[model samples]
Target: MNPETIRRRRWYILGVLTFSLLVVVLDNTILNVALKTIADPQEGLGATQSQLEWAINSYTLVFAGLLFTFGVIGDRLGRKRVLVAGMVMFGLASLLSAYSQSPAQLIGARALMGLGGAAIMPQTLSIITNVFEPQERGRAIGIWSGAVGLAIGIGPITGGLLLAHFWWGSVFLINVPVIVVGAVLIALLVPESRNPDPGRLDPVGVLLSIVGLVTLSYGIIQGGERGAWLEPGVLGPIAAGLAVLALFARHEARSDHPAFDVRLFRDPRLSAAVAAIALCFFAAAGMFFFAGFYLQSVRGLSAFQSGAMLLPFAVAQILFSTRSAAMVHRFGAKAVCATGLLLVAAALASYPVLGIGTGTPLWVLGAVFFVQGAGMANVMPPATESVMSALPREKAGAGSALNNTARQVAVAMGVAVLGSVLASIYRGELAERLAALPPGARTVAAESIEGAHAVAERLGAAGQGLIGPANAAFTEAMRTAAGAAAVIAFLGALVVLKWMPGRTAHREPERAERAERAERGTGREKARGRRAASRERTRV
Candidate 1:
C-alpha cells in the first residue's frame, strides 16, 4: 500500500522481467557457441555450412516472422497471458531442442522456440511501458535494456561452460528452471494489461507479413551462405517473399483495422527508432556471429574460452546501459545514436587488424569490444526509448513489437550477410592458399579448412611454415568483411540522425500519460518483488 512497499515490489517485477528476457536473449547468443558443438558432436558436430546457417537463422526467422502478429495478440488478449503462454511453449521447445538428433531437428526446434519467443519478447518492453512513468521509464527501459546486454554478454561464457561440462543440449536445458521461476513470479506480481481498444486482427496483413518476412529472410540467408545472389534456390524464396510483402503493404493501407498502422512511418521518431533497431542489431549480430569464428577458428580458443574472452563486451554494456539513457536524455536519441553507431563502426573496422594473430593481445581485443559494447549500450536503450516515447500509451504493445521485430529481422539478415561474407572470404582464401600445393595436399587442405582447422595435415613439416601466411590471408579477408559490414552499420546511424524527430522543449500529455502507466508498472514491479521475497523467506 505504501510507496516504500511499492518500491520493494517494483524490483521483484523487474527480476521476473529480466529473468524471462534472459531466457530469450541467452537462447539467441548461447546458440552462437553451441552451433559447432551441435553440428559436429564427435569431432564437434561436423555441421555443414548450410546446416550451421540454419542453426542460427531458423530461430531468428521464426522470431522475426511472428513478432508483429503476437504483439497484436498481446494487445487483443492480454500481455501477461500471452507472455505466460509463450513461456510454456518456449520451455517445451527448449526441451525439444535438447533432444534434437540432427541439425534439421535442432533447426526445427529452434524455429519453434522462436515462435514462443515472438510471443515472449515484446512483453518485456511493453510491460515497462505499461508500468513505468515517463521520466522513470527512460531509466527503467535502460535497466531492461541492460538485462538484454547481460544475457548476450554472458551467453557465450555460460554456454561454453555448460558445453564443457555437459552436452550442447545443456544450454537449452538451463532455460528450463529459469523460465519456471520466472513464470510463477510473473503470474503473481505482474498485473494484466492490454490495449484499452485493441484493434481487430488483420489476417490479410498477417499473411502478407509472414510471406514478406519469410521470403526476404530466406533470400538473405541463402544468398549469404551460397555466396551468390542469383542462385535459383536463393532468389526464388526472396522474390516470393518480396512479392508477398508488397501485397501485405497494400492490404495494410486498405484494411480497416490493419495489423499495424503502416502510416507510423510518417513519424520521424518512429521511423528512426525502427531504423536504429535494424542497423544496431545488424552490427551486433554480425559481431557475435563472426566473433565466434574469430575466437574459435582463427584464434584457436575453446568454446568456453571464446565465451570468456567476450567478458569485456558484456561488462562494458552493463556498466554503460544506464549511462547511455542519461546521455540520451541530455543530448537526445539522435546524437546518442549517431555517436554509438560511429563507435560500433570503429570497433568493427578495428577487427581486421586486431584479428591477425593467434596470440592477439587481450587488451587490444578487449578495448575494441568495450568500445563496441558502449556503442551497443547506447544504441539499444536510446532506440527503445525513442520508439516507446514516440507512440501513444495505447499503441505501446504494437510499437514495442514492431521495434523488436525489426531487431529480430536485422539480426537474421546481418548474420546471413556478414556470416556469408566471412564464410566466402575464409573459403576463397583457403582455396587460393591451397592451390599451390600438390593434389593430395590440396584435398587435405580444403577438407581441413572447411572443418575449421587452421592448418592442413598432409603438408606436415613443410606446411607448418605456410600457416603464418595462410592465417594472415584469412584474417585479412575477415577484416575486409568486417569493415564492409561496419560501413553499412554506420550508414544506419546516419539514417537515424537525419530522420528521427528533434527533441521538444516539453514532454507532451501522451508522454505524461505514458509516464503514469510506467509508475503503475513500477507498482506492479514492487508487487512481484514482495511476492518473490516472501517465497524466498518461506523456503528459508
Candidate 2:
C-alpha cells in the first residue's frame, strides 16, 4: 500500500527481468567461444565453416525477423503471458540445442530459441515502462541495459570456462536452469500488462516485415564473409528486402489498424534515442567481432586468456551504470548521452594508434575497453529511458519492439558493412604481398587471417615472411574499422545533443508539486493526495 513497498517490489521484479535478459543476451555472445568446440572433428559435429556461421546467423535472422510481430502479439494478448511462454520455449529449445546430433538440428534449435527470444525481449522493457513511474524509469532501464553489456562482456568468459571443463553442449545446457528460475520468478513477481487498444494483428504486415528482415539479414551475414556485396545473390536479396520493407511501411501508413506505428519516429527524442542505440550497437558489435581475431591472431592470446582480459569491460559497465541514471537525473539525458558517445568515439579512435609491438598495448587496450564500456553504459539507459518516455503507455510493447529491432538490424549491418570494409582493406593489402606466392597458397592467404596462418604452415619456414604482411594487413583493417566506428559514435553524440530534449519536456512536474504540498501540509494537498492514492490503488 505504501510507495516504499511498491518500490521494493518493483526492484525485485527488475532483478528477475535482468536475469531473464542475461539468458537471451548471453546466447548472443556465449556461442562464439564454443563454435570451434562444437565443430571439432573428433569430439563434436564435423561442421563446415558455413554451418558454423549459420549456427549464429540463423538465430539472428529469425530473431530480427520476428521481433515486431511478437511485440504486437504480446501487446494484444498479454506481456506476462507471452513472456512466460517465451521462457518455456527458450528452455526447451536450449535442451534441443544441447542434444543436437547434426548441424541442421542445432541450427533449427537455435532458430527456435530466437523465436522465443523475440517474444521475451520486447516485453521486459514494456512491462517496466507500464509499472515504473517517470522519475524511476531511468534507473530501472539503466539496470536492465547494464545487464546486456555485462552479459556480453562476460559471455565469452563463461563459455570459455565451460568449454574448457566440459563438453561443447554444456554451453547450451546452461540456459536450462536459468530459464526455469526466470520462469518461476516471472510467474510470481512480474505483473501482467498489455495495450488497452492493441487493435487487430495485420497478417500482411507481419509477412512483409518478416520477409524483408530475414532477407536483408541473410544478405548481410553471407555477404560480409563471402565478399558478395555486389554479387547478384547478395544484391538481389538486398534489393528485394528493401523493397519489401518499403512496401510494409507504405502499407502500414495507409492502414487504419497498422501492426506497428511508424509515426513514432516523428518524435525527435525517440528518433534520436533509437539512432543512438543503433549506432552504438553498430560500433560495439563490429569492434568485439573483429577484435577477437586481432587479439588471438595478431597478439597470439589463447581464447580463455583473451576472454579473461576482457573482464574489465563488464566491470566498468556494472560499476558505472547504476549511477548513470543519477547522472541523467542531474545533468539530463542529452548531456550525459553526448559525453558517453564521445567517450566511446575517443576509445574507438585510440585503438588503431596503440602500437601492438609495444609492451603497453594490452594495458592500453584494457583502459580503452573500460572507457568504451562505461560510455556504452551511459548511452543505453538514458537514451532508452528517453525513448520509452516518448511513447504512450499503451504502445509500449510495439514501441519497445521497434527500438530493439532497430538495434538488431544495426548489429547485423555492422557485422556486414564494417566487416566488409575491413575485409576489403585486408584483401587489398594482402594482394600485393601474396602475388609472388603459389596460386593455391595465394588464394588461401588472401581469404582470411586463419587461412593465411594455414598457408604459412603449409609453406614451413619459407612462409615465415608472410606472417609480417598478414599481420600488417589485419592491423590496417582494424584501424580502418575502428576509425569508421569512431565517426559513427561521434555522429550519434552530435545527434543526441542536437535532437534529444532534456527534462524540460520529459520530466513530470506533479512530483515536485506533491512534495511541496506534503511539506506545507495544505488541506487541498491532503484532499488531492487521498484521491490520487485511491486512483493508484484501483490501478494496482
Candidate 3:
C-alpha cells in the first residue's frame, strides 16, 4: 500500500477500535439512569438494593476476573478473531439481559455480557499499543481513552431518551446493532494481530482470579447490605477472597510463565498508573451511582433532565481529553497525573460540602464536576501511555490486561465499596426514623432510597412527611460516601507524585542507550592510553 493510504488506514483502524470498545464501555453506566425505572414496581422489575448492586457489579466482577484469561486467549488466538467473537457474544448477552424478567436473570445476562467485554477491552488497548509507534502512541491512546468519556457521556443521555420512550430493556438492546456494525467494520478494515510467542494458558491462575474477584465483590455487597463487616456473610468471603488472591500471587511469584506478571508492579510508573485510573474510576462510579438517585428521586429531575445536567461533565471531559496528550508531553505524566488526582480529590471532597439544592451550591457542584472531568481526562490517557510504553510490544496484551484488570476491579469496588458506604449510611438513617411504619413497610423503606420513595408513594398524604427526612438522610449518606472517595483520590494523587516517573519517562530508553555508548567510549580510551604507556616503557 502507498504511504498515504497506509497512514489513513491506521486512523481508520483507530475508528474501528473505538466503536467496538464503545459497545462494551457504554453498557456499564448506561444502566445507571435506568436503575430508577427498573426498580419501579409498577412499570418495571422491582429490584432491591442488593439486586441493584448486582446489576452493575455482576458485569464488572466477571469482566475484571476474566480479563487476563481472555487477554492471554486473544494473544494465542487472533486478536481480530477473538474480538469478532466477543462482539457476537456481547450482542447475544445484551439480548438476554434486555429480555430477562427477574433480577437474577438480568444479573446472569449481565455476567455473560461481562464475559464478552473481558475479551474485547484488553485487545483494544493492546492493539493500539502495538500498532502505534512511540511518538504517536500517546495521541492514539488519548483518542482511545477519549472514547471512554464519550461512552459515559452518551450512555446517560441515550439511556434517558430510551427510557422516556421505551422500556428499560431498550438500553441493552441498543448495543446489539452497534456491535453488529462494529463487527462488520472490523471484518473489513482491521488487521488480525496476536503475540507470536504467547505463553501456555494458566488455568490455575484463571480459576483463582475468577474466584477471588467474585468472592471479594460478594463480601463487599454483603457487608453493605448487612452493615456488619464481622459477620460470616461479610468476613468469611472477604478472607477467603483475599486468601485466594494471595495464593494466586504466590502462584504467579513461583510460576515459570505467569499469566499476568506480578513483577510489573515493580515499576512504579505502571503500578501508579493503574492506581490512578482505578481510584479516579472509583470516585466517578460512586458519584454517578448516587447522582442518579439524587437527581431523579430527591431533586425530582426526570432522567432526561438528569442526563442534560451531566453535560458539563461530559463537555469538560471532551475538552480536556483533546488536550491531554499535549499536556502530558508538556507537563509529563507524573505532574499531569498528580494534578488531575488532586482535582478529583477536591471535587469529591466538595461533594458532601456542596448541596444538591438548585442554588449557588449546585452551581458550585457543576464547577466541581467540570474540574473533576478535566482531572480524569488528564489521568487516563497519560497513565495508559505511561503503562503501555513501559511494556514491550510482545507483552502488550498481558500489560493491557493487567492495567484494565485494575480498572475493572476498581470500578466494581467503586460500586461495591463506595455504594456500601452509601448504603450503610442510607439504611442507618432510615432505620429508627422508619421504625414508625408497619414492619413490612419499614423494612422496605430502609432497604434503599428508591424503596423509601415507593413506600412514601404508597402511604398517600401521610407519607409526604417522610420525603423531607428521607431525602435529607440520603443526602447526608451521599456526603459521607463522597468524602471517602475523595480520600482515595487524594491518596492516589500522592502516589502519582511520589512514585510515577517524570518528563524523562519516555526518554529512559534513549538515556540508557546513551549511557552504554559513553561506557564503551571510555573503555576504548583507557585501552589506547594503556597501550601507549606500555610502548613508552618498552622504548625506555
Steric overlap count per candidate: 21, 0, 0
Question: Can you rank all candidates by TM-score, best first?
Answer: 3, 2, 1
TM-score of 3: 0.92
Residue pair clashes in candidate 3: none
User: What is the per-residue lDDT of model 2 for residues 1-540, given as tens digits with 9 covering 90 to 100?
Assistant: 355665669988898899998999998777866654564546678564446556766776667767777888888889999999999999999999999999999999998998899889999999888778866777889999999889988988898788778888888999999999999999988887778887677788777877887677666655655654788888888888899999989998888766656777898989999999889888877777666667766787766766776788899889878889888778888888888899899989886766443234587788888999989988988888877877778878877887788777777667666766777778787877789899988866776665686678789999999988898888888788898999999999989888988766555543664686678777778889999999999999
**Best by the TM-score measure:** 3
For candidate 3, what is the lDDT?
0.85
* lDDT per residue as tens, model 3, 411-528: 8889988889988898788777788898898878887888998989999998987788888888889889989999999999998888889888756754676788899999999999
Give RMSD to native, each candidate.
8.4, 5.0, 6.3
Q: Can you tell me which runs of candidate 3 are displaced by over 4 Å? A: 1-6, 355-362, 509-540
Per-residue error (Å), model 1, residue 143 = 0.7
- List of clashing residue pairs for candidate 2: none
lDDT for each residue of candidate 1 in 141-247, tens digit (9 for 90 to 100) = 88988898888889999999998899888989988998899899889887778888987777777667766776777677667556567889988988888888888
Compared with the true structure, all predictions reach lDDT values of 0.78, 0.80, 0.85
